[model samples]
Target: MNTKNEGVISEIERYAIKDGPGIRTVVFLKGCPLKCRWCANPETQKSIYQLMYWPNRCIACKQCILECPNNALSWGNPGIQICRADCASCGACTQICNSQALTMAGQHKTADEIMQIILKDLPYYQTSGGGVTFSGGEAASQGEFLCKLAKECKKHRISTCIETCGYAKWEIFCELLPYIDYFFYDLKIIDEKDHMTYTGVSNKLILDNFSRLIQAKADVTVRIPVIPGINNTQKNVEQTIRFLLEQAPGCPVSLLPYHRLGASKYDKLDMEYTLAELAPPSEKEMFQLKEQFVSFGFPVRIGE
Candidate 1:
Protein backbone atom coordinates (compact mmCIF):
# COMPACT_ATOMS: atom_id res chain seq x y z
CA MET A 1 0.00 0.00 0.00
CA ASN A 2 1.19 3.48 -0.78
CA THR A 3 1.80 5.84 2.15
CA LYS A 4 -0.03 9.16 2.66
CA ASN A 5 3.13 11.22 2.16
CA GLU A 6 3.05 10.86 -1.61
CA GLY A 7 0.49 13.56 -2.54
CA VAL A 8 1.26 17.28 -2.19
CA ILE A 9 -1.65 19.73 -1.61
CA SER A 10 -1.87 23.51 -1.51
CA GLU A 11 -5.05 24.54 0.39
CA ILE A 12 -8.01 22.89 2.08
CA GLU A 13 -11.22 24.96 2.14
CA ARG A 14 -14.14 23.87 4.25
CA TYR A 15 -17.87 24.59 3.72
CA ALA A 16 -17.64 25.25 0.02
CA ILE A 17 -20.96 25.65 -1.85
CA LYS A 18 -20.01 25.08 -5.46
CA ASP A 19 -18.05 21.82 -5.18
CA GLY A 20 -20.62 19.14 -4.41
CA PRO A 21 -23.82 18.08 -2.64
CA GLY A 22 -24.73 20.18 0.43
CA ILE A 23 -21.54 21.58 2.06
CA ARG A 24 -18.06 20.33 1.17
CA THR A 25 -14.41 20.40 2.15
CA VAL A 26 -12.66 21.38 -1.07
CA VAL A 27 -9.02 20.32 -1.42
CA PHE A 28 -7.32 22.58 -3.96
CA LEU A 29 -4.33 20.90 -5.63
CA LYS A 30 -1.79 23.04 -7.43
CA GLY A 31 -0.61 22.75 -11.07
CA CYS A 32 -2.47 22.98 -14.36
CA PRO A 33 -1.61 22.74 -18.08
CA LEU A 34 -4.45 24.89 -19.44
CA LYS A 35 -4.21 28.69 -19.56
CA CYS A 36 -7.81 29.86 -19.80
CA ARG A 37 -8.21 33.54 -20.57
CA TRP A 38 -10.66 34.05 -17.69
CA CYS A 39 -9.44 31.59 -15.07
CA ALA A 40 -10.55 32.54 -11.55
CA ASN A 41 -7.75 30.68 -9.79
CA PRO A 42 -4.65 31.81 -11.63
CA GLU A 43 -2.45 30.98 -8.65
CA THR A 44 -3.18 27.28 -9.20
CA GLN A 45 -1.70 27.44 -12.71
CA LYS A 46 1.90 26.95 -11.55
CA SER A 47 3.12 23.82 -9.78
CA ILE A 48 5.33 25.65 -7.26
CA TYR A 49 5.10 28.51 -4.82
CA GLN A 50 4.83 31.98 -6.42
CA LEU A 51 4.99 35.53 -5.11
CA MET A 52 1.91 37.74 -5.26
CA TYR A 53 1.78 41.44 -4.52
CA TRP A 54 -1.17 43.73 -3.78
CA PRO A 55 -0.60 47.33 -4.65
CA ASN A 56 -3.41 48.50 -2.36
CA ARG A 57 -1.69 46.99 0.68
CA CYS A 58 1.63 48.70 0.02
CA ILE A 59 2.32 51.62 2.37
CA ALA A 60 5.48 52.63 0.45
CA CYS A 61 7.57 51.21 3.32
CA LYS A 62 9.94 49.35 0.92
CA GLN A 63 10.59 46.82 3.67
CA CYS A 64 10.17 43.90 1.26
CA ILE A 65 12.90 45.21 -1.01
CA LEU A 66 15.40 45.40 1.85
CA GLU A 67 14.48 41.98 3.25
CA CYS A 68 14.54 40.10 -0.07
CA PRO A 69 17.63 37.87 0.13
CA ASN A 70 17.77 37.26 -3.64
CA ASN A 71 17.67 41.00 -4.48
CA ALA A 72 14.54 40.21 -6.47
CA LEU A 73 12.49 43.00 -4.91
CA SER A 74 13.34 46.54 -5.97
CA TRP A 75 11.59 49.87 -5.52
CA GLY A 76 10.44 51.61 -8.68
CA ASN A 77 8.71 54.97 -9.25
CA PRO A 78 5.34 53.22 -9.65
CA GLY A 79 5.73 50.71 -6.79
CA ILE A 80 7.90 47.60 -6.38
CA GLN A 81 9.60 45.51 -9.03
CA ILE A 82 9.77 41.77 -8.37
CA CYS A 83 12.05 39.78 -10.64
CA ARG A 84 10.15 36.60 -11.29
CA ALA A 85 13.19 34.85 -12.75
CA ASP A 86 15.39 35.72 -9.77
CA CYS A 87 12.78 35.29 -7.00
CA ALA A 88 12.63 31.75 -5.57
CA SER A 89 9.49 32.45 -3.46
CA CYS A 90 11.44 31.93 -0.21
CA GLY A 91 8.71 34.17 1.39
CA ALA A 92 11.33 36.26 3.22
CA CYS A 93 9.82 39.43 1.80
CA THR A 94 6.28 38.27 2.45
CA GLN A 95 7.17 37.60 6.07
CA ILE A 96 8.70 41.02 6.66
CA CYS A 97 6.08 43.07 4.77
CA ASN A 98 4.13 44.85 7.57
CA SER A 99 1.58 46.11 5.04
CA GLN A 100 0.79 42.58 3.78
CA ALA A 101 1.45 43.65 0.23
CA LEU A 102 3.51 40.59 -0.69
CA THR A 103 2.18 37.03 -0.39
CA MET A 104 3.08 33.49 -1.46
CA ALA A 105 0.83 31.06 -3.33
CA GLY A 106 1.66 27.37 -2.79
CA GLN A 107 2.53 25.30 0.30
CA HIS A 108 3.32 21.59 0.68
CA LYS A 109 1.31 19.22 2.89
CA THR A 110 1.06 15.44 2.93
CA ALA A 111 -2.26 13.60 2.47
CA ASP A 112 -2.33 12.64 6.16
CA GLU A 113 -1.86 16.27 7.14
CA ILE A 114 -4.67 17.29 4.78
CA MET A 115 -7.01 14.56 6.01
CA GLN A 116 -6.50 15.67 9.57
CA ILE A 117 -7.68 19.18 8.70
CA ILE A 118 -10.64 17.78 6.72
CA LEU A 119 -11.82 15.46 9.52
CA LYS A 120 -12.21 18.44 11.83
CA ASP A 121 -15.31 19.43 9.89
CA LEU A 122 -16.85 15.97 9.98
CA PRO A 123 -19.76 17.14 12.06
CA TYR A 124 -20.71 19.74 9.51
CA TYR A 125 -20.31 17.20 6.71
CA GLN A 126 -22.56 14.75 8.52
CA THR A 127 -25.34 17.28 9.10
CA SER A 128 -25.12 18.78 5.64
CA GLY A 129 -24.53 15.55 3.72
CA GLY A 130 -21.34 17.11 2.43
CA GLY A 131 -18.03 15.36 1.92
CA VAL A 132 -14.49 15.90 0.72
CA THR A 133 -14.05 17.22 -2.82
CA PHE A 134 -10.65 17.15 -4.52
CA SER A 135 -10.47 20.04 -6.96
CA GLY A 136 -7.68 21.33 -9.19
CA GLY A 137 -5.74 22.75 -11.37
CA GLU A 138 -7.01 19.35 -12.59
CA ALA A 139 -7.04 16.76 -9.81
CA ALA A 140 -6.39 13.96 -12.28
CA SER A 141 -3.05 15.60 -13.13
CA GLN A 142 -1.89 14.25 -9.78
CA GLY A 143 -3.66 10.89 -10.12
CA GLU A 144 -1.43 8.71 -7.95
CA PHE A 145 -1.73 11.00 -4.94
CA LEU A 146 -5.46 11.57 -5.42
CA CYS A 147 -6.18 7.85 -5.70
CA LYS A 148 -4.40 7.16 -2.41
CA LEU A 149 -6.21 9.99 -0.64
CA ALA A 150 -9.56 8.79 -1.94
CA LYS A 151 -8.83 5.30 -0.59
CA GLU A 152 -7.92 6.73 2.77
CA CYS A 153 -11.12 8.75 2.90
CA LYS A 154 -13.09 5.62 2.06
CA LYS A 155 -11.44 3.68 4.88
CA HIS A 156 -12.69 6.36 7.27
CA ARG A 157 -16.21 6.22 5.74
CA ILE A 158 -15.89 9.80 4.54
CA SER A 159 -17.66 10.49 1.25
CA THR A 160 -15.44 11.65 -1.59
CA CYS A 161 -15.88 13.59 -4.83
CA ILE A 162 -13.70 15.16 -7.56
CA GLU A 163 -14.10 18.29 -9.64
CA THR A 164 -12.11 17.92 -12.86
CA CYS A 165 -11.61 19.33 -16.35
CA GLY A 166 -11.56 15.72 -17.65
CA TYR A 167 -8.34 16.18 -19.62
CA ALA A 168 -6.65 13.09 -18.21
CA LYS A 169 -5.76 9.49 -18.93
CA TRP A 170 -8.66 7.00 -18.92
CA GLU A 171 -7.01 4.47 -16.61
CA ILE A 172 -6.23 7.07 -13.99
CA PHE A 173 -9.77 8.48 -14.06
CA CYS A 174 -11.24 4.99 -13.87
CA GLU A 175 -9.16 4.12 -10.84
CA LEU A 176 -10.54 7.11 -8.94
CA LEU A 177 -14.16 6.86 -10.14
CA PRO A 178 -15.25 4.13 -7.72
CA TYR A 179 -13.99 6.19 -4.82
CA ILE A 180 -15.87 9.32 -5.95
CA ASP A 181 -19.58 9.51 -5.07
CA TYR A 182 -20.24 12.48 -7.32
CA PHE A 183 -18.20 14.22 -10.01
CA PHE A 184 -18.41 17.95 -10.77
CA TYR A 185 -17.14 17.82 -14.35
CA ASP A 186 -16.56 20.91 -16.46
CA LEU A 187 -17.75 21.15 -20.09
CA LYS A 188 -16.60 24.29 -21.82
CA ILE A 189 -16.59 24.87 -25.60
CA ILE A 190 -17.67 21.93 -27.73
CA ASP A 191 -15.67 22.88 -30.83
CA GLU A 192 -12.12 21.58 -30.75
CA LYS A 193 -10.60 24.70 -32.29
CA ASP A 194 -12.57 27.08 -30.09
CA HIS A 195 -11.71 25.02 -27.01
CA MET A 196 -8.02 25.10 -27.79
CA THR A 197 -8.17 28.81 -28.55
CA TYR A 198 -9.72 29.70 -25.23
CA THR A 199 -8.26 27.02 -22.93
CA GLY A 200 -4.88 26.08 -24.49
CA VAL A 201 -5.86 22.41 -24.98
CA SER A 202 -7.98 20.37 -27.36
CA ASN A 203 -11.39 19.14 -26.16
CA LYS A 204 -10.80 15.69 -27.60
CA LEU A 205 -9.46 14.24 -24.35
CA ILE A 206 -12.19 15.90 -22.31
CA LEU A 207 -14.98 14.67 -24.58
CA ASP A 208 -13.54 11.18 -24.69
CA ASN A 209 -13.26 11.04 -20.93
CA PHE A 210 -16.84 12.24 -20.52
CA SER A 211 -18.01 9.44 -22.77
CA ARG A 212 -15.99 6.93 -20.78
CA LEU A 213 -17.49 8.20 -17.54
CA ILE A 214 -20.98 7.73 -18.95
CA GLN A 215 -20.15 4.21 -20.10
CA ALA A 216 -18.87 3.41 -16.65
CA LYS A 217 -22.07 4.93 -15.18
CA ALA A 218 -20.35 7.37 -12.86
CA ASP A 219 -22.52 9.90 -11.06
CA VAL A 220 -21.66 13.24 -12.65
CA THR A 221 -22.88 16.83 -12.60
CA VAL A 222 -21.73 18.70 -15.72
CA ARG A 223 -20.80 22.35 -15.09
CA ILE A 224 -20.56 25.02 -17.81
CA PRO A 225 -18.97 28.39 -17.12
CA VAL A 226 -20.98 30.73 -19.34
CA ILE A 227 -18.69 33.52 -20.48
CA PRO A 228 -20.19 36.35 -22.52
CA GLY A 229 -19.12 36.83 -26.18
CA ILE A 230 -17.20 33.57 -25.87
CA ASN A 231 -19.59 30.69 -25.16
CA ASN A 232 -22.88 32.47 -24.42
CA THR A 233 -24.20 32.16 -27.97
CA GLN A 234 -27.14 30.02 -28.95
CA LYS A 235 -24.99 27.88 -31.21
CA ASN A 236 -22.59 26.95 -28.45
CA VAL A 237 -25.38 26.21 -25.98
CA GLU A 238 -27.22 24.03 -28.50
CA GLN A 239 -24.10 22.09 -29.36
CA THR A 240 -23.28 21.58 -25.66
CA ILE A 241 -26.79 20.41 -24.85
CA ARG A 242 -26.75 17.97 -27.76
CA PHE A 243 -23.40 16.54 -26.65
CA LEU A 244 -24.53 16.10 -23.05
CA LEU A 245 -27.84 14.55 -24.07
CA GLU A 246 -26.17 12.02 -26.32
CA GLN A 247 -23.44 11.23 -23.81
CA ALA A 248 -24.94 11.43 -20.32
CA PRO A 249 -28.64 11.75 -21.04
CA GLY A 250 -30.23 12.45 -17.66
CA CYS A 251 -27.23 14.00 -15.89
CA PRO A 252 -27.84 17.40 -14.29
CA VAL A 253 -25.94 20.44 -15.60
CA SER A 254 -25.20 23.74 -13.87
CA LEU A 255 -24.61 26.96 -15.79
CA LEU A 256 -22.02 29.06 -13.99
CA PRO A 257 -22.07 32.66 -15.20
CA TYR A 258 -18.65 34.29 -15.49
CA HIS A 259 -17.67 37.17 -13.21
CA ARG A 260 -14.81 39.67 -12.87
CA LEU A 261 -13.94 38.25 -9.44
CA GLY A 262 -10.51 37.06 -10.58
CA ALA A 263 -9.57 40.27 -12.36
CA SER A 264 -7.80 41.66 -9.31
CA LYS A 265 -5.73 38.50 -8.92
CA TYR A 266 -4.29 38.96 -12.42
CA ASP A 267 -2.89 42.31 -11.36
CA LYS A 268 -1.41 40.79 -8.20
CA LEU A 269 0.35 38.12 -10.24
CA ASP A 270 1.61 40.76 -12.70
CA MET A 271 -0.19 38.98 -15.55
CA GLU A 272 -2.11 40.73 -18.28
CA TYR A 273 -5.89 40.48 -18.07
CA THR A 274 -7.11 39.28 -21.47
CA LEU A 275 -10.83 39.59 -20.67
CA ALA A 276 -10.58 42.94 -18.96
CA GLU A 277 -13.16 44.46 -21.28
CA LEU A 278 -15.38 41.41 -21.35
CA ALA A 279 -18.40 41.68 -19.05
CA PRO A 280 -20.39 38.86 -17.56
CA PRO A 281 -23.47 37.56 -19.35
CA SER A 282 -26.71 39.26 -18.43
CA GLU A 283 -29.46 37.53 -16.40
CA LYS A 284 -31.50 37.25 -19.59
CA GLU A 285 -28.61 35.51 -21.35
CA MET A 286 -28.17 33.03 -18.50
CA PHE A 287 -31.92 32.33 -18.48
CA GLN A 288 -31.81 31.76 -22.23
CA LEU A 289 -29.15 29.09 -21.81
CA LYS A 290 -31.15 27.51 -19.01
CA GLU A 291 -34.26 27.47 -21.18
CA GLN A 292 -32.37 25.75 -23.99
CA PHE A 293 -31.21 22.99 -21.64
CA VAL A 294 -34.68 22.67 -20.11
CA SER A 295 -36.14 22.15 -23.59
CA PHE A 296 -33.99 19.05 -23.87
CA GLY A 297 -35.68 17.55 -20.78
CA PHE A 298 -32.51 17.58 -18.70
CA PRO A 299 -32.39 18.87 -15.13
CA VAL A 300 -30.53 22.19 -15.03
CA ARG A 301 -29.68 24.81 -12.44
CA ILE A 302 -28.42 28.37 -12.82
CA GLY A 303 -25.57 28.11 -10.32
CA GLU A 304 -24.02 25.83 -7.75
Candidate 2:
Protein backbone atom coordinates (compact mmCIF):
# COMPACT_ATOMS: atom_id res chain seq x y z
CA MET A 1 0.00 0.00 0.00
CA ASN A 2 2.40 2.64 -1.15
CA THR A 3 1.23 6.24 -1.05
CA LYS A 4 3.01 6.98 -4.32
CA ASN A 5 1.22 4.30 -6.32
CA GLU A 6 -1.14 5.84 -8.90
CA GLY A 7 -4.07 4.56 -10.98
CA VAL A 8 -6.28 5.72 -13.85
CA ILE A 9 -9.67 6.85 -12.59
CA SER A 10 -12.79 8.09 -14.34
CA GLU A 11 -14.40 10.07 -11.53
CA ILE A 12 -14.54 10.59 -7.76
CA GLU A 13 -18.23 11.04 -7.03
CA ARG A 14 -19.20 12.37 -3.62
CA TYR A 15 -22.22 11.79 -1.37
CA ALA A 16 -23.48 8.69 -3.11
CA ILE A 17 -25.83 6.83 -0.74
CA LYS A 18 -26.98 3.87 -2.84
CA ASP A 19 -23.49 2.41 -3.34
CA GLY A 20 -23.53 1.06 0.20
CA PRO A 21 -24.97 1.68 3.63
CA GLY A 22 -25.07 5.37 4.66
CA ILE A 23 -23.40 8.19 2.68
CA ARG A 24 -20.49 7.21 0.40
CA THR A 25 -17.99 8.66 -2.01
CA VAL A 26 -17.62 6.38 -5.01
CA VAL A 27 -14.22 6.15 -6.72
CA PHE A 28 -14.84 5.01 -10.28
CA LEU A 29 -11.84 3.04 -11.54
CA LYS A 30 -11.17 2.58 -15.23
CA GLY A 31 -10.96 -0.61 -17.39
CA CYS A 32 -13.13 -3.75 -17.52
CA PRO A 33 -12.99 -7.28 -18.88
CA LEU A 34 -16.64 -7.40 -19.80
CA LYS A 35 -18.44 -5.24 -22.40
CA CYS A 36 -21.96 -5.26 -21.04
CA ARG A 37 -24.18 -3.47 -23.56
CA TRP A 38 -26.14 -1.72 -20.82
CA CYS A 39 -23.10 -0.26 -19.07
CA ALA A 40 -24.01 3.21 -17.83
CA ASN A 41 -20.45 4.42 -17.51
CA PRO A 42 -19.11 3.50 -20.91
CA GLU A 43 -16.38 6.06 -20.36
CA THR A 44 -14.86 3.93 -17.59
CA GLN A 45 -14.35 0.80 -19.70
CA LYS A 46 -11.11 1.98 -21.25
CA SER A 47 -8.11 2.95 -19.16
CA ILE A 48 -6.91 5.50 -21.68
CA TYR A 49 -8.02 9.11 -21.84
CA GLN A 50 -10.65 9.62 -24.56
CA LEU A 51 -12.21 12.61 -26.27
CA MET A 52 -16.01 12.85 -26.18
CA TYR A 53 -17.92 14.90 -28.71
CA TRP A 54 -21.46 16.20 -28.38
CA PRO A 55 -22.79 17.17 -31.81
CA ASN A 56 -25.78 19.09 -30.49
CA ARG A 57 -23.58 21.33 -28.37
CA CYS A 58 -21.47 22.31 -31.33
CA ILE A 59 -22.31 25.81 -32.52
CA ALA A 60 -20.23 25.10 -35.60
CA CYS A 61 -17.36 26.46 -33.53
CA LYS A 62 -14.12 25.95 -35.45
CA GLN A 63 -12.14 26.48 -32.26
CA CYS A 64 -11.47 22.76 -31.70
CA ILE A 65 -10.53 22.22 -35.35
CA LEU A 66 -8.15 25.15 -35.48
CA GLU A 67 -6.59 24.43 -32.06
CA CYS A 68 -6.03 20.70 -32.56
CA PRO A 69 -2.24 20.36 -32.74
CA ASN A 70 -2.33 17.08 -34.67
CA ASN A 71 -4.99 18.20 -37.14
CA ALA A 72 -7.23 15.50 -35.64
CA LEU A 73 -10.39 17.57 -35.65
CA SER A 74 -12.28 19.15 -38.55
CA TRP A 75 -15.61 20.88 -39.05
CA GLY A 76 -18.28 18.51 -40.35
CA ASN A 77 -21.59 19.96 -41.51
CA PRO A 78 -22.78 21.04 -38.06
CA GLY A 79 -20.84 18.46 -35.99
CA ILE A 80 -17.15 18.25 -35.16
CA GLN A 81 -15.05 15.70 -36.98
CA ILE A 82 -12.73 13.69 -34.76
CA CYS A 83 -9.85 11.63 -36.10
CA ARG A 84 -9.66 9.46 -33.00
CA ALA A 85 -6.64 7.58 -34.30
CA ASP A 86 -4.65 10.79 -34.56
CA CYS A 87 -6.08 12.61 -31.54
CA ALA A 88 -3.87 12.59 -28.41
CA SER A 89 -6.58 13.47 -25.87
CA CYS A 90 -4.43 16.33 -24.59
CA GLY A 91 -7.49 18.52 -23.77
CA ALA A 92 -6.16 21.40 -25.88
CA CYS A 93 -9.44 21.73 -27.73
CA THR A 94 -11.55 21.16 -24.63
CA GLN A 95 -9.70 24.06 -23.02
CA ILE A 96 -10.51 26.52 -25.79
CA CYS A 97 -14.04 25.36 -26.57
CA ASN A 98 -16.63 27.36 -24.65
CA SER A 99 -19.81 25.26 -25.06
CA GLN A 100 -18.36 22.11 -23.56
CA ALA A 101 -19.16 20.44 -26.89
CA LEU A 102 -16.12 18.27 -26.23
CA THR A 103 -15.11 16.41 -23.05
CA MET A 104 -12.46 14.03 -21.86
CA ALA A 105 -12.69 10.93 -19.74
CA GLY A 106 -10.16 9.37 -17.32
CA GLN A 107 -7.73 11.01 -14.96
CA HIS A 108 -4.56 9.82 -13.26
CA LYS A 109 -4.28 10.04 -9.46
CA THR A 110 -2.20 8.53 -6.70
CA ALA A 111 -3.61 6.86 -3.60
CA ASP A 112 -2.37 9.73 -1.45
CA GLU A 113 -3.83 12.35 -3.76
CA ILE A 114 -7.26 10.72 -4.01
CA MET A 115 -7.60 10.26 -0.26
CA GLN A 116 -6.90 13.94 0.23
CA ILE A 117 -9.93 14.69 -1.94
CA ILE A 118 -12.04 11.98 -0.30
CA LEU A 119 -11.11 13.10 3.22
CA LYS A 120 -12.90 16.41 2.62
CA ASP A 121 -16.20 14.55 3.14
CA LEU A 122 -14.98 12.64 6.19
CA PRO A 123 -17.27 14.59 8.46
CA TYR A 124 -20.33 13.56 6.46
CA TYR A 125 -19.25 9.93 6.51
CA GLN A 126 -18.53 9.95 10.23
CA THR A 127 -21.87 11.46 11.12
CA SER A 128 -23.90 9.40 8.64
CA GLY A 129 -22.11 6.08 9.15
CA GLY A 130 -20.88 6.33 5.58
CA GLY A 131 -17.52 5.61 4.02
CA VAL A 132 -15.94 5.14 0.58
CA THR A 133 -16.92 2.74 -2.20
CA PHE A 134 -14.43 1.67 -4.88
CA SER A 135 -16.38 0.92 -8.05
CA GLY A 136 -15.54 0.37 -11.69
CA GLY A 137 -15.38 -0.75 -14.90
CA GLU A 138 -14.33 -3.70 -12.52
CA ALA A 139 -12.03 -2.59 -9.72
CA ALA A 140 -10.52 -6.09 -9.70
CA SER A 141 -8.79 -5.37 -13.01
CA GLN A 142 -6.77 -2.66 -11.27
CA GLY A 143 -5.81 -4.97 -8.40
CA GLU A 144 -2.56 -3.37 -7.28
CA PHE A 145 -3.99 0.16 -7.14
CA LEU A 146 -7.35 -0.86 -5.64
CA CYS A 147 -5.74 -2.85 -2.83
CA LYS A 148 -3.29 -0.11 -1.96
CA LEU A 149 -5.92 2.63 -1.88
CA ALA A 150 -8.36 0.50 0.09
CA LYS A 151 -5.69 -0.30 2.65
CA GLU A 152 -5.02 3.41 3.04
CA CYS A 153 -8.70 3.87 3.86
CA LYS A 154 -8.42 1.05 6.37
CA LYS A 155 -5.47 2.79 8.02
CA HIS A 156 -7.80 5.69 8.73
CA ARG A 157 -10.48 3.26 10.05
CA ILE A 158 -12.81 4.09 7.16
CA SER A 159 -15.12 1.34 5.94
CA THR A 160 -14.50 0.26 2.34
CA CYS A 161 -16.95 -1.20 -0.18
CA ILE A 162 -16.36 -2.44 -3.74
CA GLU A 163 -18.61 -2.74 -6.77
CA THR A 164 -17.14 -5.50 -8.88
CA CYS A 165 -18.00 -7.52 -11.97
CA GLY A 166 -16.29 -10.63 -10.47
CA TYR A 167 -14.40 -11.36 -13.72
CA ALA A 168 -10.81 -11.07 -12.54
CA LYS A 169 -8.35 -13.83 -11.61
CA TRP A 170 -9.35 -15.52 -8.37
CA GLU A 171 -6.03 -14.65 -6.81
CA ILE A 172 -6.64 -10.94 -7.35
CA PHE A 173 -10.13 -11.11 -5.88
CA CYS A 174 -8.93 -13.21 -2.91
CA GLU A 175 -6.13 -10.80 -2.05
CA LEU A 176 -8.61 -7.88 -1.99
CA LEU A 177 -11.06 -9.46 0.48
CA PRO A 178 -9.14 -8.33 3.55
CA TYR A 179 -9.27 -4.66 2.62
CA ILE A 180 -12.87 -4.50 1.44
CA ASP A 181 -15.66 -4.46 4.06
CA TYR A 182 -18.63 -4.86 1.70
CA PHE A 183 -18.95 -6.09 -1.91
CA PHE A 184 -21.52 -5.18 -4.51
CA TYR A 185 -21.23 -8.19 -6.83
CA ASP A 186 -22.96 -8.24 -10.18
CA LEU A 187 -24.50 -11.51 -11.42
CA LYS A 188 -25.93 -10.65 -14.81
CA ILE A 189 -26.75 -14.10 -16.16
CA ILE A 190 -26.34 -17.76 -15.23
CA ASP A 191 -26.10 -19.25 -18.72
CA GLU A 192 -22.66 -19.07 -20.22
CA LYS A 193 -23.75 -18.86 -23.86
CA ASP A 194 -26.22 -16.03 -23.27
CA HIS A 195 -23.84 -14.31 -20.94
CA MET A 196 -21.10 -14.20 -23.54
CA THR A 197 -23.52 -13.04 -26.20
CA TYR A 198 -24.65 -10.08 -24.13
CA THR A 199 -21.61 -9.12 -22.08
CA GLY A 200 -18.82 -10.09 -24.53
CA VAL A 201 -17.36 -12.55 -21.98
CA SER A 202 -18.14 -15.84 -20.26
CA ASN A 203 -19.68 -15.83 -16.78
CA LYS A 204 -17.80 -18.94 -15.68
CA LEU A 205 -15.16 -16.98 -13.82
CA ILE A 206 -17.69 -14.63 -12.31
CA LEU A 207 -19.73 -17.51 -10.96
CA ASP A 208 -16.65 -19.32 -9.69
CA ASN A 209 -15.38 -16.20 -7.95
CA PHE A 210 -18.78 -15.67 -6.34
CA SER A 211 -18.81 -19.27 -5.12
CA ARG A 212 -15.49 -18.69 -3.42
CA LEU A 213 -16.79 -15.50 -1.80
CA ILE A 214 -19.75 -17.41 -0.40
CA GLN A 215 -17.51 -20.19 0.87
CA ALA A 216 -15.19 -17.63 2.40
CA LYS A 217 -18.21 -16.07 4.15
CA ALA A 218 -17.40 -12.59 2.91
CA ASP A 219 -19.92 -9.76 3.30
CA VAL A 220 -21.42 -9.88 -0.20
CA THR A 221 -24.57 -8.50 -1.72
CA VAL A 222 -25.58 -9.69 -5.20
CA ARG A 223 -26.79 -7.09 -7.72
CA ILE A 224 -28.73 -8.10 -10.83
CA PRO A 225 -29.62 -5.50 -13.43
CA VAL A 226 -33.15 -6.17 -14.62
CA ILE A 227 -32.64 -5.51 -18.34
CA PRO A 228 -36.08 -5.73 -19.88
CA GLY A 229 -35.29 -7.73 -23.02
CA ILE A 230 -32.44 -9.70 -21.55
CA ASN A 231 -32.32 -11.36 -18.11
CA ASN A 232 -35.57 -10.06 -16.65
CA THR A 233 -37.71 -12.92 -17.84
CA GLN A 234 -39.32 -15.34 -15.39
CA LYS A 235 -37.20 -18.23 -16.61
CA ASN A 236 -33.90 -16.37 -16.13
CA VAL A 237 -35.00 -15.03 -12.74
CA GLU A 238 -35.85 -18.51 -11.49
CA GLN A 239 -32.63 -19.94 -12.86
CA THR A 240 -30.58 -17.19 -11.20
CA ILE A 241 -32.36 -17.67 -7.87
CA ARG A 242 -31.81 -21.42 -7.96
CA PHE A 243 -28.11 -20.95 -8.60
CA LEU A 244 -27.75 -18.37 -5.82
CA LEU A 245 -29.59 -20.56 -3.32
CA GLU A 246 -27.36 -23.47 -4.16
CA GLN A 247 -24.17 -21.48 -3.73
CA ALA A 248 -25.16 -19.07 -0.94
CA PRO A 249 -28.51 -19.81 0.61
CA GLY A 250 -30.47 -16.82 1.92
CA CYS A 251 -27.94 -14.45 0.33
CA PRO A 252 -29.27 -10.94 -0.09
CA VAL A 253 -30.09 -9.85 -3.64
CA SER A 254 -30.73 -6.41 -5.08
CA LEU A 255 -32.58 -6.05 -8.39
CA LEU A 256 -31.39 -2.94 -10.19
CA PRO A 257 -34.14 -2.04 -12.60
CA TYR A 258 -32.62 -0.84 -15.85
CA HIS A 259 -32.75 2.85 -16.75
CA ARG A 260 -31.74 4.99 -19.70
CA LEU A 261 -29.80 7.38 -17.51
CA GLY A 262 -26.51 6.32 -19.08
CA ALA A 263 -27.81 6.38 -22.59
CA SER A 264 -26.38 9.83 -23.06
CA LYS A 265 -22.94 8.58 -22.03
CA TYR A 266 -22.98 6.25 -24.99
CA ASP A 267 -23.82 9.22 -27.18
CA LYS A 268 -21.01 11.17 -25.59
CA LEU A 269 -18.54 8.41 -26.41
CA ASP A 270 -19.84 7.97 -29.99
CA MET A 271 -20.79 4.35 -29.30
CA GLU A 272 -23.91 2.55 -30.33
CA TYR A 273 -26.55 1.77 -27.71
CA THR A 274 -27.64 -1.82 -28.23
CA LEU A 275 -30.62 -1.49 -25.94
CA ALA A 276 -31.57 1.79 -27.59
CA GLU A 277 -35.33 1.20 -27.78
CA LEU A 278 -35.76 -1.40 -25.05
CA ALA A 279 -37.56 -0.07 -21.99
CA PRO A 280 -36.77 -0.78 -18.38
CA PRO A 281 -38.96 -3.19 -16.44
CA SER A 282 -42.16 -1.69 -15.08
CA GLU A 283 -42.70 -1.34 -11.31
CA LYS A 284 -45.08 -4.27 -11.40
CA GLU A 285 -42.53 -6.43 -13.15
CA MET A 286 -39.79 -5.51 -10.71
CA PHE A 287 -41.96 -6.34 -7.69
CA GLN A 288 -43.10 -9.60 -9.22
CA LEU A 289 -39.47 -10.57 -9.70
CA LYS A 290 -38.73 -9.55 -6.12
CA GLU A 291 -41.55 -11.76 -4.91
CA GLN A 292 -40.14 -14.63 -6.92
CA PHE A 293 -36.74 -14.32 -5.22
CA VAL A 294 -38.45 -13.99 -1.82
CA SER A 295 -40.48 -17.12 -2.58
CA PHE A 296 -37.18 -18.96 -2.76
CA GLY A 297 -36.34 -17.60 0.70
CA PHE A 298 -33.70 -15.11 -0.44
CA PRO A 299 -33.89 -11.61 1.00
CA VAL A 300 -34.61 -9.11 -1.78
CA ARG A 301 -34.21 -5.38 -2.39
CA ILE A 302 -35.46 -3.41 -5.35
CA GLY A 303 -33.56 -0.58 -7.06
CA GLU A 304 -31.15 -0.26 -4.14
TM-scores across all candidates? 0.96, 0.96
User: What is the overall TM-score of model 2 with all chains considered together?
Assistant: 0.96
Clash totals in order: 0, 0
Cα-based lDDT for every prediction: 0.85, 0.89
lDDT of 1 by residue, 1-304 (tens): 2333555456788889767877889998888778889899888887788789988889998888888889998888568888999998899998998888898888887778888988898888888888899987877777888888888888878889898889888988888887889888899999899999999999998999999998999988898999998887778887998898889887898999999898889878888889999988889988888888888888999877
On a 0 to 100 scale, what is the lDDT of residue 4 in model 1?
39
Query: Which candidate achieves the best TM-score against the true structure?
Result: 2
Could you tell me which residue pairs clash in candidate 1? none
Superposition-based RMSD of candidate 2 using all C-alpha atoms, in angstroms: 1.5
Q: What's the true lDDT of residue 165 in model 2?
A: 91
lDDT of 2 by residue, 1-304 (tens): 2333899999999999999988999999999999999999899898899899888787885888889999998876558878888999999999998999888898899988999988998888899999999998888788889988888998888889999999998887787788889989999988899999999999999999999998988999999999986898667887898898899889999999999998988867768898889888899999998999999898999998
Any runs in candidate 1 off by more than 4 Å, and if so which? 1-8
- Give residue 164's error in model 1 in angstroms: 0.8
